[model samples]
Target: MQQLPSNSISLFCFFCMLLSSSYAKPRISSPAFAANSCNFPAIFNFGDSNSDTGGISAALYPINWPYGQTYFHMPAGRFSDGRLIIDFIAESFGLPYLSAYLDSVGTNFSHGANFATGGSTIRVPDRILPTNEGFGFSPFYLDIQLSQFMLFKSRSQMIRQRGGIYASLMPQEEYFSQALYTFDIGQNDFTADLFADMPIEKIYASVPDVINSFAYNVKSIYNSGGRSFWIHNTGPLGCYAFVFLYSPSAPALKDSAGCVKPYNELAQYFNLKLKEAVVQLRKAFPSAAFTYVDVYSIKYSLFKEPEKYGTSSVSHTTYGMEEVRINTTLH
Candidate 1:
């Protein structure tokens, strides 16, 4: 097993690094291996709403308005008006859009399929879904989307056998190991239910358990032969639209500008916890690679510095966040 720093050492390193690099921001390497060099065949996705392209919004699950209206001109199945960080990731990989398997009626998924649904959880028996990526927040349980992904992989193999991208790319075993696996999820477990009135202590207590559950699922995928992965973590849930409206008990602070402190703090804490988890996961899964994409940072940057994104508005409600999120989602 690959060993990471203990909590104390990791904390020390984090601060030391922060102090040493305070003058410079963190550098983000490309999300993809160069198409010519990367061995992974097709990309696979798994996650909750933030990474959700259209899983829930399309199913008419009462998503916020103005979602995906900017870039898509209407809801393009994303919480935002445009593409997401994952979309950019696809582009960086020189792959085509990861069409949701649910929307794969006519699209060709030679590249891969997106199994990320809008509301999913890592461990809990989600009223939100059947597998982790819950189904439409509905009454009937849907079959595991993993089944769809397996089918897609099968077809991808056929395409390769017939001298498709697979043949064009590389051999089979290398393809499997090198294939980029993206697991973006767990935000809904923190946000959707808490906003529905779960207690704050309960939320905190559940974090480790939830992370463990997420780890279990990740192990499940690893055992199934997944290698490279993008492990997503819980989101800053209290900042969204209904959060402020429904539960005002945990009272997030705000400046004159009205930035919600409670929400931001909860988000920051979640990010910290997730960062720690990533270190642990990396240690556990050395053969397979994983990168932690801090969506919270990307999302926060867009919200804090609206000018960078070229958008005119800095709205706060879930609707506003989604609007800004849409642009961030896009290139």
Candidate 2:
């Protein structure tokens, strides 16, 4: 149960406050408005496993625990022991946890839908794996996720036009347009390159193209009438168990933070370019309110002070990769 930092929590709260003020009108109000002072109608998320609720489950079932042991008491397709940061954000806004877009049965998506998938990348890489089986390219890359979102919007619009249950809740346009749009991707893109043994320089060089694709997707969503965005930068990849297990550097090259210096540097480089691209995106969409969340700093704090965050060991927060490796090998 890795928790978001207090500062990150406050940041999200501040965003909610801003959203409340921006959407509030003097003329009309409803019971839902009275029930929750800051009633954001919906939330839409795009990301990798960091925010994936159940995309993996819908595609591949019987994923074993301790995946969702903390919260749901059963595997719920999230990569962690409990809820993701996005789940908490949704709860703070008085919205239900978003259902995975691919989840078919018993899913309530009136509030919003999640298009994130495990192992999704920002862009499909040019190089395929060198394995004899010719495997390991992410099928649900950001572009395809955006396309799925477009389809979701279309279907929701059709349902609204047909006077369905969703039409009573909110207009499809408003649902898509007013909902908070969030992006928490790009980690897998770097990880993919790293796993493929691409040169470090070549991996660094891919940042611009990755950010460009991300920015383009943002603009596309803006064109579709989205006006608010919360973008999370990549966290400290070097601190994760996967990095320690598979990509360890020399002890001398480790940072004071206990993370491999080179891997953290790569993450920082990506975050830097991402922030710059977001600045340009703000210029491109004058009406959109873009909030860049510093997830790297927040997550690094957990690594720095695991005890303070209610974890006896840092291993509790980041054993996903280790679990995956063990499970895959066992199967």
The digit string of per-residue lDDT tens for model 2 on 1-331 reads 2344454344445554444445442111111111122345788899887888888668655446877876788888787777788999898877888899888866777888899877677888553332244334346778988999999888777877889565654335767766788899988788756655678999898889999999988889989988778788888877776765555443456777677778789999998898888778777766677777677776777667666666644553343331221111100
Residue pairs in collision within model 2 = none
Task: Residues 172-228, candidate 1: write the lDDT tens digits.
Answer: 534445566777665555565555566667777777776666666667667767776
For all candidates, what are the clash counts?
14, 0
| Candidate 1 Cα outliers beyond 4 Å, as residue runs | 1-40, 57-68, 129-174, 249-252, 255-257, 308-312, 316-331
Candidates' lDDT values, in order? 0.55, 0.70
lDDT of 2: 0.70
The most accurate candidate by TM-score is: 2
